[model samples]
Structure formats: structure tokens, C-alpha cells
Target: MDKSPDAYWKATLRLIGTVLVIWFAVSYLAGIVFAPALNSIHLGGYPLGFWFAQQGSIYVFVALIFWYAKKMDDIDREFDVHED
Candidate 1:
């Protein structure tokens, strides 16, 4: 089935929004707001929260970038808008 341009755009925007929200939650909420609680857990001799703040968020961000790209590629294919 084919989707209209408007529908394709809306789907793209929704995907972007969802990815941003996940990024924010990991970067802000986990790294800062819930850091204290997360600190109670240990990861490789360092506090889990500290790890999230110092490295995990960056890792998640990079992973998210790849994930987003792959998802968008799939979306483009679904919408019949993929590049050659």
C-alpha cells in the first residue's frame, strides 16, 4: 500500500519525537534526576548513575543515532520514498 506525503511526514515526525524523548530520558532523567537512586547500583566498580552521566548517555546517544537512521530507512522504504 502507498502512503501520502502528508502521512509520510507525520510518521517521520513521530519517529523523531519518540527518539528525542528517549534521548532526553536517558541523558537527563537517568543521568541527573535519578542519579542518586541509580548510584545505589554498581557497575564495574563505579556508581551506575555516574556511569550513565559520564559515559552511558553518550553511548546511548550514538546507538540512538544508528537506530534512528535504520528506523528512518525502514520508514522511507515503507513510504516508497527511499533513496537509490
Candidate 2:
């Protein structure tokens, strides 16, 4: 099956939008906005919120980077545009 450029681009854009939303929620909402509430929780003797602010988000970001690359490859293959 073949995909038009418009459809492929739309898929790419949607993937980007989804990744951005996830990144924002983890980095901003969890790390800062909800930090106070999350402070009640603990991980390895440190506040969960603090962990998120200092380290968790970075880990999540790196994971997302890999996930995004994998997803992009999948999308490219689906659209028959992937490099071999």
C-alpha cells in the first residue's frame, strides 16, 4: 500500500504533538506544578517531587527521545519512506 505525502506528514505531526505533550506533562506538571503534592511521597530517602525535578524528568526525556526515534522509524516504514 502507498501513502500520500499529506497523510505521512499528518502522522509525523501527530506523533510530534503527542511526544511534546508527554514531555511537558512529565517535566512541568510533575516536576514543578505538582511537586508540593508529590513531596509527600519518597524514593530512596528523597522526596519524589525532588527526584522528578532533578533526575526523573531527564530520564523520562531520554527515554522519550528513544521512543520517538523508534516511533518515527515505524511511521516511516509504514509510509514506505524509510531508509533501508
Candidate 3:
């Protein structure tokens, strides 16, 4: 079935919002709010909080982008709206 433009836009916006929420939660909240507790654990020469603040969140964001692209690609195919 072909989806309306509005449906596609809404789905895209929702996907963006969801990823942003998780991005902020892990990068800022987890790195700061739970820092003390997380500091007890070490990861790759850094504390967990430091890892999340620096590398982990960045990695997760990159992964999220690729995941979102793949997911939307599938969605577009499902809606028979994918561009070549």
C-alpha cells in the first residue's frame, strides 16, 4: 500500500524524536546523573561515565543513524514509496 506524504513525514519525525530522546538520555543524563556510580566501572582506560560521555554515546549515535536509515528504508519499501 502506498502511504500518504503526511504519513511518511510523521513517521520520520517520530523516528528522529525517539532517537534524540535516547541520545540525550545516554549522553547527558547517564554521564552526569549517574557518574559517581558509573565511575566504579572502567572501560577502555576510562570510567563508565567518561566512556559514555565521550566514546559510547558517539558510537551509539552513529549506530542509531545507520539503524534509522535501514529501518526507514524498509519502511519505505513496505509503503512502496522508496526512491531508487
Misplaced by over 4 Å in model 1 are none
TM-scores, all candidates, are: 0.95, 0.95, 0.79
- Candidate 3 per-residue lDDT, tens place, 33-74, comes to 887789899988789988888778888989998999998898
RMSD of 2: 1.2
Candidate 2, residue 8: Cα displacement in angstroms equals 0.4
Angstrom error at residue 1, model 1: 4.9
Segments of candidate 3 deviating more than 4 angstroms: none
What digit string (tens of lDDT, one per residue) describes model 1 on residues 1-84? Answer: 549998999999999999989998999999999999999999999999999999999999999999999999999999988998
TM-score of 3: 0.79
User: Which 10 successive residues of model 2 have the least lDDT summed?
Assistant: 1-10
Candidate 1 lDDT score relative to the true structure: 0.95
lDDT of 2 by residue, 4-81 (tens): 999999999999999999999999999999999999999989999999999999999999999999999999999888
Better of 2 and 3 by lDDT: 2
